[model samples]
Target: MSTWTEIGDRCWVRRYDEWDLNVGLVAGSDGAVVIDTRATAEQGSELLTHIRELTDVPVRWVVNTHAHFDHVVGNSVFTDATIYLHENAAAEEDLAGTTFSVAKVIDLGDRRVELLHLGNAHTSGDTVVVVPDADVFFVGDLVEESAPPSYGEDSFPLEWPDTIDRVIGMLSDTAKVVPGHGAVVDAEFVRDQAGDIGTVANTISGLHHAGTSLADALQHTEDWPWPLEQLQDAIKRGYGALGAPRRPTLPLLGPGSSA
Candidate 1:
């Protein structure tokens, strides 16, 4: 059980060793909001206990930054609170919660928490939770510090930079940025990450336009911002986004021509 670190006025982040996950909490006069529940109901229950350490305010809301299991599976623990998830994440399963398409403003009586879906970056359904008064942004998987942003089959490598750009637009100089799984960062850190993501996007575009085969793409570029192994999915998805030509299907060998 990791201890909670205060990043803003009443905003706190708890970092866990497993998956290096970070769970957030914001307290208001009347209620509190828990951001990104851990990986399971038991973890969520434990998170609630940690929240009690800071304030006994009732947790009235549960915001799932995306549909990732690490960020949302603990939703069941907050049985009384209204769980919120992006429509896309909700579509992945029969999630019992409120679904918002673009954005949703949650009022915790004394403070307002804004949930914004900037664009497709980490995932199509990635959500950024903003504690306006506290100048804190809980960007789930959009900005990572523990590791390079995870690029899976559902990731949007090309669109990620633009999505991060939108997040950058919302930050102030002293704003504390809590990643889904890392130490709290600032706007400058996010900008650097956005730059890296942009570089990868451009590299992928350049390779695709140059008629480079996906199989040989990695061999051509040696200076990737992230590890080559981690960027494999990025390259594959980037080429896919650009509609790069697929390998032609070879016809079966004729019996007469075969030895």
Candidate 2:
């Protein structure tokens, strides 16, 4: 059986056994809004059916927390709903296939879902879904509880901590947070994770600011979470966000600076 927990009025977070990915739903009298379709069409179809069984409200909108394959890629299945995405999210190679960046507000009858692009962090188009009335937030991969936060090649490690801080600012003390993966959590869980990630980011930032060689910096991240290899990979992304190593003259995109 699929596992779900009700966090607010007609709002639920369904956790998939497959990837442990969390999908959020916020419903009102007329319709419902879905956050993060699954990785494949088959998975999306199954999820749609499960959601339909829970509520008769037709799915009116689908929001992608980010462009990651597991978090999106199911847009094709929800043909009737207006898919919402970040403007820069379309640049993601996997999501380049879909038409998005439309409809900021989804009216779930009286209750509403608002999409906010709080700068760049996880990915260029990472989107946060807010149900202010319900006091809930669906933060795609930006907040990870099932596992440690991941920093992909496209991730802005430097900006990630502040992005979490921004989400913290937007939430109420008792708000429920549905991360891209893992169990439904409270604001304090998010705060603790954000603090950890921030420490790692600040360490990398400090090393970079002090003109330490990238190699040495990677070595220094030995005590950070994740294996040395994974830590190195994440640090590299953080470094990339600052600029390419050695040749700082040819700078790439810096943290907190988005298109």
Candidate 3:
């Protein structure tokens, strides 16, 4: 089902229930701004159709919240709109860029979205799209409302809490947060999620640093709400981010081999 919630005067957060994917749309007299196109051409086409129902304004620009496949892979769908990405993503695209340490705001005529690049958070460059006037933030996967945070192979566990802190500072109690996948929530929800994820990061890092084997270290995460596979990935991210050696992939020994 295609459901949309009006967040501001002319802005909406559209959700495709099947994918649990949320895409931000902001329109003004001048043009419209689309945040994060869906993963494929077909999904992006469907999203465009949904956006067309909301506003007739032509989409002039597209902002990828991050360069993940689910987020940026739909770039090809927005042929007429200018695609913008963080410096690192630009590097991958081989485009000359500005390595913004803080953030930069793009004026969408009647609307303004501040792109804050929170270094080493969900990825090497994760940006939170802030609608200052609306007091809403389009947090990619940095803050998840549907589930616990997902740490990919590129995530930096040690830096996520601090990055989330930066996002928290930019929000107000009345602010609404649109996660990558889920219903819109408030600032407190985001804050609590960040705190819990931070705890997981710390626990994983501590266990790894204490020289706990990968299997035993994973046991410490049993109390965590995420899956074992996700925890294992986070453990690897934690170890890598902390400059610890990669977890050695030891072979399982059968009873005969053990003897």
By TM-score, the best candidate is 1
TM-score of each: 0.91, 0.87, 0.86
Give the Cα lDDT of each candidate.
Answer: 0.88, 0.81, 0.77
User: What are the per-residue Cα lDDT tens digits for candidate 3 across 1-259?
Assistant: 5777898777799887655778999776678878888888888888888888877899987887777777776667777787767877666545333444568877778778788887677777677888888787888888877867878777777888888988888788899898988889898898888888888777887677667766677666455656766767787777665665355576788877853
Q: RMSD of each candidate?
A: 5.1, 8.1, 6.8
- Higher-TM-score candidate of 1 and 2: 1
Worst 10 residues of 3 by lDDT: 92-101
163-252: candidate 1 lDDT, tens digit per residue? 999899989999999998888899999999889889888888888887789889866656588888888889988877888655557788
Mind sharing the TM-score for model 1? 0.91
Evaluated at residue 36, the lDDT of candidate 3 is: 86
Per TM-score, what order, best first?
Answer: 1, 2, 3
